[model samples]
Every structure is written in structure tokens, then in C-alpha cells.
Target: IVGIDAAIFMHPTTWKASGHVDNFNDPMIDNKDSKKRYRVDHLIEEYAAALSAEGKENEAAALLASMETLLAKDDFTGLKKMIDDNKMQCAVSHTCNWTEIRQFNLMFSTEFGTAVSSEEGNNIVYLRPETAQGIFVNFLNVQKTGRLKIPFGIAQIGKAFRNEIVARQFVFRMREFEQMEMQFFVRPGTQKEWYEKWKAKRMQWHESLGMPAAKYRFHDHVKLAHYADAACDIEYEFPIGFKELEGIHSRTDFDLQQHQQYSKKKMQYFDNDLNPETGKPYGNYIPYVIETSIGLDRMFLAVISQAYEEQDLSLPAGEAGTEEKKDSRVVLKLPPVLAPIKLAVLPLTKKDGLPAIAEEIIQACKPHFRCFYEEKDSIGKRYRRMDALGTPYCVTVDHQTKEDQT
Candidate 1:
């Protein structure tokens, strides 16, 4: 809702107020032999998976359950002992020699200027770990500028960075990634209602994208952030497994309140809308936020993983069923709206003015959406190629089209 790039480089204290300076950390362990650092949870998970693969299902489950208990309480000693006891080894080093688990801050910090020094701590700034803070800091700017009332949202898509100790499956957890976030501010007592509303709406959106509802489910948070009173993740069935694709949270005015205390600026909204209980204006107060955040890269992974398919288009046709079947075709049956290319215009032959007609079709479709034109391949080959590229449809221009311009 606000201008782009308006808050990329926020003041250093903005993060301090947002709790990133102290609270944004992941428990990490180092492999003494391999000299690699890994998030403690990830290390335990890998070891547990190995146990499962070895047919020690009960052991794996017990290990995972204990790991969660330790993680929830930030039990470093128990975490270390758990690893040592299980003989967990580094995948790289294949050795059990490991460093003690410690909290590692995920933010990537950098010197801000030529004159910046460690003594001048103000110069040390961090790349934002999340985009929600930007929206929170700019809360007043957007509300006043847009003349927005209560129960309005500020939407932003921006790049955020984190020094991930464990980067997992391709683009699943990256050091740098884009986030699509919306911070919906509402009357203080209305957060729970808005949280449930946005949760349903977001799940509906995922299903409308041609993915089956069975492939998605809600995962509630066991431990909430300091700022969040309620939170849950929308997990999608990815190729790797069911993982978080989006997060919905009820942040109960902690952000705006913190900013007000730190920045000495009032973030209160004088709501004129009457409350049903009091029949009076909600009056001046910090607005609670219901946030919906989706990782753009993770969404891409979800879409492509679900869309990709390999089909055997071959059929039994000859007598006695002795005929050879056609080779299987690989297609990305992407939803038409999400496909990179909407149509592929293929000329059946280079001669008989077929290529010219195909060119004409391309010109018309190109303005509306992406269109691919080619005359070098056979019609069947071109169709296969388009399917592989996730083009939703293909049109073959041939000699018969010249008869009546059809």
C-alpha cells in the first residue's frame, strides 16, 4: 500500500525495537571435523531421518520428540548430549566430533559507511531478516498517506536476507529471498476475528490455484513469537515433503507499541468507527496486526512441484494389441494464469505460407501474454516442447487455414 523502496534501509534501532537484535536467532552446532555449522534442529532432523531409513522408526520418533522438547526450552546441554548419545555425525565429516549448540543470530550485518567503526556502533546495520518490520515501521506513513481507516492492510513485496545456518532443498530456505506480506491493522480486540478470516482466505487462494485442498493443511505454532499471540503456517505438500508455504499470525500491537517506545513517536490510530459493545469510537490506541506472509520462492516451488506431471499418452490401437505405444510425454500442466507462456504458435510446415500465418498469430497473442513461435520442428515435436515449457495451449497453423482464413 505504501511506496516501493521507502523502508529498505531503516534506522538501526528499528530492528532493536522489533526484537530482531536479541530474539532472532537459530540454535546452531558446528562439525569439528568438517568445520561446517548447522542449525541444531536441522542436524537432529537429519540424524532422525537416518534412523528411520535404518528401520529404527521408534528410535527416530523418540529422538524427534525429545529434540522438540529441548528446542522449546533452549536446552543446549540436553541438545549436545542428545547428539553425542545418538552418535550423530556430520554428513560431510562422518564424525561425531561436534561443537556445543549455541544461539546464532541470523541477520547479516555490515558496516554502513567509510567512517563506520566498531566503536561507533551506530554504523553497524543489518540487512532486514523479515519484511514485516518495514511495514510496521511505516504503519503511520501508509495510514495517513492513503487516508486508510481501521481494518485496512498494507501490502508489500520486497527482498529480505538472513544468514541461514541450514539452507535446505532448492530455494526452500535461502539466504536471500523475496516475501509477499500484508499487515492488516485492526481494532485491538478484533485481531482474533481477522486472524481466522485471513487464514481461511489464504487457504482458499491456494486451492483456487488448481492445487487440490488435500495437498495443503494448517500447522499451528507450539511456541509463539514475543510479538505474536497466535500463529499458524499453511503447509503445502512439496516434492520434498509437506512444508511451510505461508504464515498467518495475530500480532497483538507489540510491534507498534515497541516502535512507539523506541522511536518516541505515537503509532496510535484514532478510530472513528464505533464499537458494538460501547457504541462509541474505538478511540486512540495502537492497532493490532493480523499478518499474512508468503515466501515468493517457496510459492514458486509449490506451484511448479504440483504442476509438473509425466503422462503416458500412448494407447493400444493395433489388432491383438501388438502395436508399439508412443513414448511418454512430460508436461507441466500449470494453471493457465500461472503458466509462463499462454500459447505456443507452431507452423505445421515451413512451406505453403504456414510460417507466415503462425507469425500472425504470435503477433496477436504476444501483446496479451507470452507466446512462442517456431517452424523448425514437426507439429508433434513442437507440441511436446510447448508442454514441457508449461505453455497452456498450442495452435498449429497449416495449409488448410489458407482455404477460408479459419
Candidate 2:
């Protein structure tokens, strides 16, 4: 478990250094009929889902691939044509008419100080669109203060704000969200090896959570950002369909280089390790970064989706009564380590000092893990309640427990 770090609320120049002021944007389109704006990618994804639901899996797959190709090329006209050809309609208006796609900035900006001036030059500061810039700006301070060497990493988890034109799909996309990000600094030209290493390691970490491997896939970016040399997203199958859960990016010294130029600060790291190729110590150079960024909310949604299950627990015909009915339950089968309630202490009855015994158990286990105490209902009902909460273990206190301490 990593510790939470303070968020960075910095000058607008910091955002300009990070390129967020200019490059952080999404392609957006509006439905002419409904006058509703939609992110182009979301619109295509919805259309793809409709196709998949109609038993046109091949068509849906092809449509998604085409959309990706168009986006990679930044072919906005081709994208509009694809939408028209597919006859995709706006969900709200049920019409196919659409305006030309345009770029929409995602960063939230505000005036830095109370001023009567309407000028934006010195007054405007932006809520950081991402958390990595905070790490980048403080790289030297951390390296020098910690007496660090090359190949070290800095990790952070903090809130990021975005002015999303179309924020939907529950918490998957939000104006305010949390990001768990780590930036690993490595010597120049070693970035490729480290990138591959992190890609595999991150995938393994997800699998270690006991999630099905088939439920996750890596989507390589066809169109990389200005700062990225290599990048891919770990996509998970959510209730809304497959979507990006985390991103691994090979940012080749771009961030540090930009900060160096903008801040006029030295961002280079000196390496003492001998380079096998040159048979000499590697000299000072800006470290290339491998960034692993995950959306905490998206990860939570993925976990909950996998854990939720609907089960039928009806008895066999011979063991059932004449008026027997089918019984069903909705359960969250979360992993034991991830479950909110690890243990539940339920007394069979609230009387006869049973509640006291349960409370004792709660006090003991609460220090070790999360525990829930419930004694108001029947043992069977309490067990079901624990099941709904995804509690892995339940202990019952009864009359026999008072005698044998079992």
C-alpha cells in the first residue's frame, strides 16, 4: 500500500511546461438534431456495442478497428463518414445528423488571484490535468535530497481534474478523479528494456489479483502522443464493455527535457555504472521515463464487476415441499484480501450473553482486519447479509460456544 501524496496546484507555466495547456484534449462531436455533444470515441463505442448486441460480432469488431484507424490518422472526415455509413444514431435524439468533429480541451482553468482585469496572460492558472507533472518538477529535489542514484522511481496517488465534454459510464469517466501513477527513471537507451519489463510486470500484478486473464487485454497505441515513444493500455471487460483500465507509457526524456528548457533547471542524472558498449562510465544525461498510470476508480469498477454474481440456490425436487419456490441471491464474491469486511461476528441470539461474546471476538479481530458485528437477526439472515457484503468468513456465537469456547 502506497501513501497518499499532496496534490500540486501550481502556476500556469507548469502546465505549459507539461504541454497540457495545448495538447490535453479529446475529439468531440455534436448531434445536430438533439444539440447534444458527445465524445467521438464514446459515440463509436456505443455504436459498436449496439452491433455486438445484434449478433453482428464481426461487424462490431470491424467497426471498432476502423474507428481506431481513423483516430490514429486524425482523419476526422473519415470518422464522420464511418459514422454515417454505420447509420449510428444519437441515443437521445434517435437521429443520425451530426456536426463536424472538433477538438475540446480537457483541463480546468481558473483565475489564480482575485483581479478586476479580464486578461488571461498572468491571471489564469489551471487545475492540473494529471499528476505526473508534479513528480517531474520535483525530480531533482527528490534525487538530491534522498542521495539517490539512477534507475529510481517516484510514485504518487492524487486527484486530477478534467473538463470532460461528455462524462458518462458511471465513475469510469469523471470531472474529478484519482490517479495512481509511478514514474520510473532509467538511464538513456535502457528505456526500451525497462518498458517491456514494466508491461509484463504490471500484467502479472493484475493477474495476481485472481482476475481471469481472458478478461484483460493490452491495446497498443497506434497514435502516440507528442511525448510518448511507446504506450499501451491495459483494457478490462467492464459492464459497459472493454475499456482502458491502466496505461503504460514510454516517455523518452520528453518531460524532463521540457521542464529543463522551461524552468532553466538541470534535469540530467549522472550515471556511475559502466556502459558495456563503451567500456566506460555512462555520462550525465536526462533520464528516460517509463510511466505506469492507473485510474483507481476504473480499477474499482472492474473489480466489482467481476465479483458481482447472481446465483440460484433452489433445492432438488425430492427434498422440496409441495409449495417450494426457487430461491436466488445476488452476491459479491470479492477476493478475501479485497473484501471490505474480512470477518463477521454474528451471535445466534442477542440474549444470554451471546452479544458480549461476539463483541469480544470483534475486539480481537478488528485489530487484525476489518470486522462486522451483527446480532439483531437470525444466524441464517446474518450469514446472508455477510454474503451480500462479500465477507469471507463468518463466526457464530451460540450456547455451545459458552461451554466449549469453540
Candidate 3:
């Protein structure tokens, strides 16, 4: 019920201790034939998935095994060999001649305090690639200061940056984006139950946004992060295909435990309640974490793409027309609440105060919702334009508006 602006800054060493500084690096490989760089992990994963889909399981398994070795050592040459051995081509460049794999740090680096050069102080700081760390670093502070009970979650929506080598597929994968992340603190033994609960709740959020449940699916991760005991992605059907829109992870106490060990901070919670479940005093224990992370941009894209439609709409007869016919229309069937325009006030004719009436109506409704006033085109044309933009309704102010009502 209460909220405060918490000026919580993360400890720099938290990144180092979490193995973020070391393990957060992406294996990047360039296509020698096309001069395009790509994330090697993503490239190989895509290759494996495609091959498996094509019923080439043996080839995919071999390629995946080789990719694993290549990733472990950051070996570009080995990656190239695997690509050639598996006949895997770069999805972007569509070339098989891939350059050697190299580690690319996705973190955007900056210096704090002084104008120190990389050679001098080398005071390089990273813009967070993920918001989970921020919540992890503040675990003890929020627990003690906020007086939050166990199983309570700290929710945050913040900007995160990842230096993507190939920032394609529109907003689905962006270099800079907003993340709504929540880290739920729970007793160590009960992490699985909470993880499942969050996964269900997160999927419900997507459904609540009006996307069909059939268009969204849960993809359980066979290969989980080092910190994650379990992980799953909420994938939405995009224009291209189904892709990840959000991630739900059971991170356990890996983040807090790592930060505690690295920063020498004691991150522990005590359960005072007599064991209704265990009948024992819950000793000082590192709370396990259930994390739900969602990308706002991805959600926006899913909504936009899902709402976009091109169909033939029925039109009434006009001059010289005998029967009603289908008119080619590109309409965005956007949900009213999310539509860019709520209503448009159109004048059938620009003369005889018709436009004035429209302008007045537009001005009246402008404060309430987005409205468009147009007099340059015919009423039908104006209505079509508004419809194309997904305007929910169009109010035409013609001579009828000026006539006295009985």
C-alpha cells in the first residue's frame, strides 16, 4: 500500500561475484563471406533447432555438441569448423564461411567519477544487461528496511541494455528496452511451487492483454542458466513465428549467495513462526528466488502485429454500382483501449460550416481520447483512413448536424 523512492545503488563487485563479468560475454562470430557478425550461441541454437525440425536429428546433435565445445573456450575457429561440418549456414548472412568465434561483451561500458582512460584507471562500468541483479543486490536492504515478509516480491520496471550484434526482428530483440521484473523471496525448500505459480500468472497477464491463448505457448528450457533451477519462456506468435516475449526463472539463491560471498554481505532471513509445516525454527537461511522478466517492447510488437490485418470489407453501393462489393482495406483491428486513435470527427464537405462543426467536436473529445478532424477528403475516404489507423469510431458531421431535430 505504501511506496517510497528508494535510492538503492548496486555494489560494483556484485557483477564480478555473480560471474556476470566473466560469464555474461556472448560468443560472436562473423560471416567471412558477408562481413556480418552474429551471436554464435544464437546461431548454433537456431541451426540445431532448424535441423531438428527438418528431421536431421543426428546432424543437429553433432552440431550442438561442437557448439558447446566452441562456446566453452570462446573458440571462433572451432565454431567455423562445426558450421562447416554440420553444413550450417548463418541465418542472417546465409553463408557457410564463418569467421572464428570471439567473445563480445554485451555490456555497455562507462567510467565513474574521473575522466580516466581505459589504460589508466580502466574504471569500466557496465550498464546492466538484466534487472535481476539490481533486485539481488538490494535483497537484504529491502528485507530489513521495507520490513517485507517472506514470499513477498519486489517488482521493478527499468531500462536494460544489451549490445546485440544483430538487433533485428524489430522490437522483439532490441538493444535498449524496458523490463518489468519481479523477484519473489521464498523459503529455500518451496522454490518450485512459487516458480510454477509465477509462470501461470505471467501467462495470464498476456491473455489479459487480449491476445489469444492459442497464440501464446510455454517453452520450457532444457538448457537452463547456471543460476536457474528451472526456466521457461512465454512465446508469442509473431509475424515471422513464435518467439520469446517473457521469461520465468527459478533462480534459487544463486544471485544472493554469489553477491553475499563476493561483497561480504550477510543476506539471510529468519522465520520466527513456529513450524506449522516443519515444526522447527527456520534458521538463518538464504532465501530462494523466483523471477519473472518481461520485455515491454516485445509485448508492444506482439500487440501491434497481432492487431494488424488486411482484409476485404463490405462496402455499400455507390454511383453506378448495382450490388455491394468487397473493398480492399488494410485495417488494424487494434483493441479500443490500445488503439492509437479512439475516434475521428470527419466533415463530409469542407464548406458550409461542416468542418467547423467537426473541429468543435474534435476539440470537445480531444481531452477525453485521441481524435482526428479531417476535411481534405470525402467522408468515405476519411473514414477509411481512420479505419486503417484502427480508430474505433468515425463521426461524420455533414449537413445533418446543422439541421434542427424534431
Candidate 4:
């Protein structure tokens, strides 16, 4: 619970320093039979999961292992061979005919000026693929201004853009999305410890919202990024399957180092504390970073998937008739803190000062939490409406309220 400063920045140079211009891409493959494109990794994962669900554990393991090996080696030919050997068919086409794999850049770029030209690399600027770079470039500004020390963090929530070749699965994968990220600056050689600490901390935060612990798990990356020394994902079991919901990476001064080199400016921090190895004060050096980046849109989807339910109400006892009515209603059992409507004030009847009393209660609770008022519908109907909206509490003002203080 450290105090951290938040900031937002947008600049073309930030992307250049972060290597998004050169390295932000996904392995894409086309289903020639269906004339459709799909991300290679996602397709493989889905297929493997289906095999596992169908009680083919050995086949699923082998397929996933082969896919991982080929991806690690960056062997596009080998990947295609694996697909062909397994007779993997596109979900849409139901055929094994596929085109060659290729790298597809995800960044969305546009011209900077009105002087439009069809030529490549003509004064181009890009929408940021991630929000971490903005925090990195503004490290010094925040540190100096906020008087922050080592182990401090910078956090932000903002929109990011990516030109996904095949954006599917609702809001889980989209051309534009929101990211909630925090970058912690810690002393070098202590990154491994901080990385583990944040990994556990973030997982706890997710589970605190009443989600079952079994629905979440840690997935360590077999292939690490060039800038990262260690990395893992907090994978959530969504309706489709387990997928990455957040990432925690231990970056060893990579971002600050790159920005220093490209901008020709020093991005070092001086620590007054004594270094154990040298038995002297820790001087100027670039601090290593531990980043925690989560997809805000994906988190929203996770909450909805868990909260939404279609419940069937059992018939009353002793009412054993063939024509007995069966009842059902949709409800959102959202966490109280995240629910849109916290409290609903309903008047049983619109006459005889009941509406006025309900309005008074609504005015009183509105300042404390979100409140909704309704008087047009039946009491049962109003309760059902509030239940659908995930309102945890409701107050009904009726004739009894005028007689008794309760």
C-alpha cells in the first residue's frame, strides 16, 4: 500500500524508445480453405483445450508441447508442419488447408501531418500498444517531483490500441482496449525478490473479489522476452478457457537503459543506503523495474462472467399439480464494491406520502453510495429489477412505515 503517483503521457518518441516500432508483433496464420486469419498461438491453444476436454490427455499434451517447441525456436516451417501432421482444421472451415505462417505487426500508425503521401515511413506516428512506456519515460519527473525513493511505483490506467488481425471473443480481444499498469522501481539485484512479492500480491487482489481460487492460476513463461529476466501470467478461467488476464515481469533496467541510449540522457538514481557487497553507499545507477500490467477490459469481462446467472426458482411445497407455474429470473450476483447500483429505494404505492418518504431515504443514502429510486412498478417487479442490476440492498416504503418508526 505504498503511495504512488499517477500520470499520463502520449508521444511518438516514447514508442521509438520502447521498441514497439520493431518488436510488437504476433505470429499469424491464414486458413486458406475458409479465407480467414487467426493468431497462431490462440488457435493452437483452443485446439489443445478441446482435445483435453474430449478425454485425449496424451494427444493434447503432445500437441501443446510441439507448438511450444516450435514457437520457442521461431520455426515457422516447423509450426506449419505440426499443424499439417496433426490434421488440425480451422474452426470455421473444418478443413486442414492453411497458408504459411507470417509475422503481423499490431501497432496502428498514422501520418503526423496533413502532407499525405502513399510512401512508407512518411512522418508516421503510432498509437501506443501498451501504457508502460509512458510511465517509464516520466520516471525522473515523478521521482524528483514526488520525492520518492527506491521500491516506489508509478501506476496508470489508460487506453491502448492494437491492430489485431482477428479480434474475437467479445471484449477480450479488441482493436482498442484499456490497460491498468504499475511499474515499481527497485534497487538492482533485488528485482527477483520484488518480482515474487508482486506476483503473489496481485493474485490475492483478484481473489479478494470473491472469485474462487481454483478459477485462477500462475503460468510461468517458458520463453522470456528480450527485456525481461523473469515473467509470469495470472491466468483466469474464462468461459472459453484459461487465458492471460495480467502479466508480471522483472525488467532489468531495460526501459530506462534504452531511453537513456536513444535520448542521450542519463536515467540513473542515487541511493544513499549502504551496499552490502561494497560496504559503501550505493551511488548512481539505473534502477531495475518490476511491472504489473492488467487488461481492464478483460477484468470487466471476468467479473461479468462470474456474476451473471440464470437461476430457476423451485415451485412451492405442497403445490403438486401438473399445471403448477415454473418461475425463473436472471440475476447479477456482483461483488458489492463493484456493483453499479448499491441500494434501491422503492415505494410500494405512489399515494399517501409513501413516495415522499422513499425519496427522503434515497436522498440520505445517495451521498454514501449509489442509490436508485422507483415507484412505477409492482413491489415484486421492482425487487426483480434491482436483483438484475446487482443491487445488494433495498428499502421498501409502505403504509407500515407511517405507523411504525421501523
Candidate 5:
């Protein structure tokens, strides 16, 4: 449950052995006429969302299924046909003639040594693209040193890079972003049970955030990854549509086994006592891993989208006033826990010591929470400004406050 910085310099070997060195990439295609590069998956997802918005849910579902099938099969022709049939226009180009998808490496390359005397071993280094490798590499070290029991998990929140071809939809898929991930260690034969537990736990975590249950769905992966026995994504309904925000995978010792073979090291745990039910040496076995990974940026974006609102806030009391004079305002309506600025201090008047009082209040509250003080324009304008910035509370200092008995 505790968060720690997973420092670099400890995971390069893990990345290399995990096929991340070769496979941590996305297929990007460019429109010849538009000179814009796009990640094919993103483009298709946008098209799907648009179809749904137009009340064409059946068409949207069919298009999404077809796209998934084509992507899994790597059938470029079929993918293009799906896009054409759906009238998928490039957000960048607004045209249908997109280029054939090409692989784009996500890892960023760097050199370790001097450019002049760089020898064969000194040339290439890559910025770690994913933080999962760090957890995988440290699995045995943590268990042995921290004395962590099996069935416990290591949770990490760290930066990862993807060199996204199309970094759009605000912060959904950025080139550099943060990830919150947990890798749970379990007995080899009992991974299925643990996997189900972790899946429920992860879903509960999302539900605790207070988003609608209907807007989130479990998408079981039809095609499994190299390491996964079973996997499912907790897809959230974004402003765009339902898409993956978090993934839960049952990785059955593939990571530890790969690293052990590649590094020439044994990664196994020993147990002193035997299980009476099974009655065998409970010793020296690589634990199966159940992983729950969520992209922080995507989760933040989903929260913002869900919380953003435009509503008629005019009270019935305001009906007595003219339509132009009626009090109606657009409010961000962000949850208090996630509001960027929790409080805003406004001076009722610029002159008469109100500004000074507001400043004093700001100084007092800044140590406790994020706050803003303003004396510009009218009090109503300042409140409106704070509302636009998603400030949850606005406090105005007035002449009455300056005359406090205390």
C-alpha cells in the first residue's frame, strides 16, 4: 500500500529479457496527404465514440468488434475496410486515405559513454519504457530482504514513456506519463484464485472513487499476451467512449522464469514448513504473479471528464429578476478530494483593509491546503473565476471581518 520511487539503474536487464526491448512499441501510420502521424488504435476508438454519440450504438459495437479482430490478426486490409465502412476520418487530416500502419518504437535511446571513444559495449542505452520491469526484477530481492510473505503485493507509481505517435484526447495517452501498478505474488497452482481476488479488489478501488458503476465494465481479453494466462481490462466510459483505464493480468511466472534464464540466476522462494493438505516440499518455487496496472494520466482524465458539467443553476428566487439579471453560472462541480484548488479567498473591497485580511487568511491556509487570494474586480467576478478553475470553496473577507471582537 505504501508508495516508493522505483529508481532506475536496477531494471535494464529485466526490460531486455522481457521482450520489452523489442516489443514495447506501437504501430503508427501517417496520412500521405495530411503529413500527420497517428496511432491506429486511437483513431479507431475516436470513430467508435462518434458513432455512439450519433445514436448508432449497434454500428459502433460492430465497428469496434471488427477493429479488434483486425488488430489481433494484423490484417491491414480488413482494418482499412472497417475504417472505410465506418467513414472514419482522421482527426488530423479529415480524410480517409491514411497510410499503412508501421511500427514505432516506444523506447527512447541514449548513449552511455563518450561519443568519440564509444566501444561496442558503450553505444546504446534506452530510457525504461515501463515500470513493470522494475517490480519483476526486484521480486526475489524484496521477498528475501523485506521478509514479505507470499500472497502480499508490491505496488508502484512511477513514470513510464511510450513515444506515442498521436498524443491526443487531452492526457489519455501521453508520451510521458505516470502509472500505478501492483504485482501480487501467489502460490503457483493457486494463481487463478488470487487473480480473481485481485480483479475484484481493483474494481472496488475504482468504484470507491464514486464514478458510476454503469460507466465501467470488465473487458476480458479475447487474445492473451505472451505472459498472461488470463487478463481483463477495467474499461471506463470516457468523454470519447468506453476504453481501457486499467488492466488486470494473470502472469504465471513468465517474468521470473525469463529473467532467471537470461540472468543465469535462480529466482525461487523456499518454505520451511509443508502444506498438510498437499504434503510436498513447499520450497524453491517461482510465485505466479497477478498484476493490476493503471495509467495515472488516463485515470485523471476520466475523472475530469466525468466531473465536468454544464447545468442550469438559476435558483427559483432569481425568477423575479429579468432574464439577463438572473443568477446563473457554470460550475466545474469537481469532487472536493480532487479539486485542484480547494479554497479561494476574495476581498470584498480593494480599499478598506479587506485585501490585507484576505492576504493574511491566504498565508494561514496555504500551509494546510492549496488556496488562492484575489482582490481583482468585483467579488462576484472573483467567485466566477475561482469556479472556472474548479475551486471548491470561496471565502470573502469584508468590513465585518475586519471589525472582529477577537
Candidate 6:
């Protein structure tokens, strides 16, 4: 299927059709003294971790269990009580002066066009909070136009915005970020199989990066979302902790059905294949969707963290001198396909046709992949710089190349 780039701004009613208007919210609370707000789950998680750090293992576990229970029940009063009972304090206030937990909408809103008259109502617009909705709205159009068959996918990479109250951990959780999302359409009962397939495939893709296997684990969602029948996260062990790097969800026709209801449009597919049981064509039905959504910035941070290395080139303990004891280099050992710069052309010296040879090689190879040519620094220093930039290959031009054309 052709890739899609969804518009960042859609009709205001688009969100309402997608259920973001009524349900896409985070529970947040503020400190009365400092007026600092925090997402309820983040606050509770931080407090629970602190409890475990203080060696209160059982207490932390119980607190987390209760918090989850309260959250599932939507018992905001009990949630606030739990926070107050545990004496969770704000980072700024240092006191347990907390206000009641309230639901906060995460979508950022804006006005679209200027009104020409006083009678004109405000033309409110919203930045899309997720790319999946865009995919849902366009699924039928692409499926019929491209003649895509069942089990086909529509993938997109686009920016999304959220008014995150507790946006922290750098790019892990940001107000504005990009997402790479794919929604696979399939028969209603087959979504589970497809969901599992994508879970394994996505994990395999991450493992192929050659990072340690111990650093990744699948975290199945204990509480499914409003639209998801099954969901799980591909979590990577970042410096902060094992956070979600990608998500795989089985969304069972909720998105398409909602849009159909709101827009009065038929979002159904006509399957001509005969159903074995009834010996009749399965016709006119909404398809189940299996979605794999990867956070682009989070994946970038994860790759960078995994590729960075501090290598020790010092001699062996028994066989070497102490002069080279501290010899080391910092390198970004990125894979060739993913590295930003693929090749570096270095000249051994500024003269003797060496720099000219490097430039010739650069001209020959520049079209295929990114190339960097340098003669300002020593060869060793230039190599180090290329390593730091994560260039996977370095071609050094010297007098030997001029002699033998090697």
C-alpha cells in the first residue's frame, strides 16, 4: 500500500467521532501549595518506586495494586485518598497539600479561521492526538482505490500533539512528537492471530539491531483501552526504566463503526470470498484492525542508547605496558542501514594527489550513500570523528592507492 501523510489538523468533529471528545483524558492532580500539576499514574508510580527504594517492598507492591484497582474503577476519591494516605509530596512544594484529582483532556485545541462577524461561532479545531484515527477515516478509500486485498496494511508517519501534564523523561513523553503507525485490516475473527504475528515481528525487528536480548520484554496491557480488545507494549530498558517503545493493539472495528455512525457513510467492505459454513459470500461488514504503533522519538533514543559504547583499546594485563593503560575511544556502533552517514573518505595527506583521490572516490560513491571527505585532521583523528558520527565504513586514500589503485 502507498504510504500516507495525514494532516495534523482535521475537522473538530473528527475527534468527537473518534471518542477523544468524551474519553481521551488523563487523571491529573495538583499540589495546592506549589500549584504544580502531575498525572495521577506518574505520581503514583514515582511514589511506589521511592517506597521500594526505601526497602518497603511489600508496601510498594500493595500501594501499586491498590492504585491500579482504584484507577480501573474510576474511583477518583479513593485515588486521592490513596495519595494522601501514602503522603506523596510534590517535588516543588515538599508537602502533601494535594487537590482533588480531575480529568484533563490531552488534546491541544486552537481556532482555525478568523470570524468576520460577531454572530459567527468560534471555529474550533484540534491537532490530531493519534495517527490511527486518520488511518481509520481513509481505510475504505485506499482499500478500494488501490484494490488492496484483505490482510493489507495502511501505514503512516505523522506528528501528533498532546497536552501532557507530566511530560518528562526527555523525548520519551513529549507534547509534540512523531509516530510511525500501521493499521492492518483483516477478517473480524482473525485479528487475534494478526496481532500476535505483529508482536513477534516488531520485537524481531528491534532484536535485529543487535542490542542485548535482556533489554527488551513484552508488557501485556492489564487494562485494555476503550476500543482495544487486546493490547501490549514492546518495552525497552532505557536508562530511566523499561518504557513503551512500541504498541500492538487489536482494535475490533470500533474506529470504523464510530466514523460510520458520525458521518453517515458506509465504512463496510464487501468480501466476495465464499464462507465455507454457509457456502455464501461474506459481504458488507466492517473489518477488524490490528495496529502496530511505534513512537519515532522514543525509538531514536532507544537506538542511540543501545549503540553508544565506550571501548577500551588498552593492552592485556600480563603482556602489555602501562603507557597504554588509559587508551580508549567513544564510538556509536550504529548499523549500516540505519546510520545517518554511511561512508567517510579520508585522505592520508593533503598533497601527493591523495586529497584528489579522496575527492574522486567521494564523487563516485556519493550518489549511492552519504559520504564525508576530510583532510584537515590526522587520519587517526578523522577515523575517530567518523566513528563518533556513526559512519559504518571509512575509505582511506593514500600513496598505496595511487601506486596500485587499491
Residue-wise C-alpha lDDT for candidate 5, range 1-406, written one tens digit per residue: 3334576544456667888777676667777778887777777877777878899999888877877887777777777666676667766668888777777778776666556544564456667677777887777777777887777788899888767666777888787899998888888899999888988988888888767889999999976777899999999999776789999999999998999999999988886557888897687788899999999999988888877766566556456554433456667767777787999988888899778888888999999999988888988788877877788898888888978812
lDDT against the true structure, per candidate, is 0.87, 0.88, 0.79, 0.87, 0.80, 0.89
Q: List, residue by residue over 1-406, the lDDT tens digit for candidate 6.
A: 4677777888777799889988999999999999999999999999988988999989989988888788878899999988888889998989999989999999998877666535543577899999988888888889989988787899999899999887888788999999999999999898989998999998898888767789999988877788999999999999987989999999999999999999999999999989898999988799999999999999999988888998888877565764445578989989787899998998899999998888889999989988888898789999999888899999998899999988
Cα deviation in Å at residue 221, candidate 6? Answer: 0.9
lDDT of 4 by residue, 1-406 (tens): 1333333335667677787777777888988879989888878888888899899999899989888888878889998887788787898899988999998889998767677668867577777888888788879988889888898998888888899987889999999999989999999999999999999999989988877799999999887877899999999999988889999999889999999988888999988989888999999999999999999999999999998999988675558466556788989999887888899988889999999888889888889998999998699999999889999898999899989934
Over 1-406, each residue of candidate 3 has an lDDT whose tens digit, in order, gives 1122222234457668777777777777778877878787777888788888999999888877777665656567777677677777865667688676677777776767766565863565677887778877777777788888787888787788888887888788888998888888899889999999988888887787667889999988766777898999999889777888899999988988888888787888987766677998887889998988899999889988988888866778874289888768788888787888889887888789887887888888989988877778667787778878988888887787899410
Instruction: Score residue 138 of candidate 4 by CA lDDT.
Output: 79
Clashes of 3: 2
lDDT (10s digit) by residue, model 2, range 33-128: 899999998899888888889999998899889898999898999998988888889988999999999989998877766766666467877888
TM-score of 1: 0.89
Off by over 4 Å in 6: 116-122, 309-330, 359-368, 402-406
lDDT of 5: 0.80
- Candidate 2 global lDDT: 0.88
lDDT head-to-head 4 vs 5, winner: 4
Candidates 3 and 4 compared: the better one by lDDT is 4
lDDT of 1 by residue, 266-337 (tens): 999998888788999778999999999999999998888888899986776673277866768889989887
Give the lDDT of residue 357 in candidate 3.
Answer: 80
**What TM-score would you give candidate 2 relative to the actual structure?**
0.90
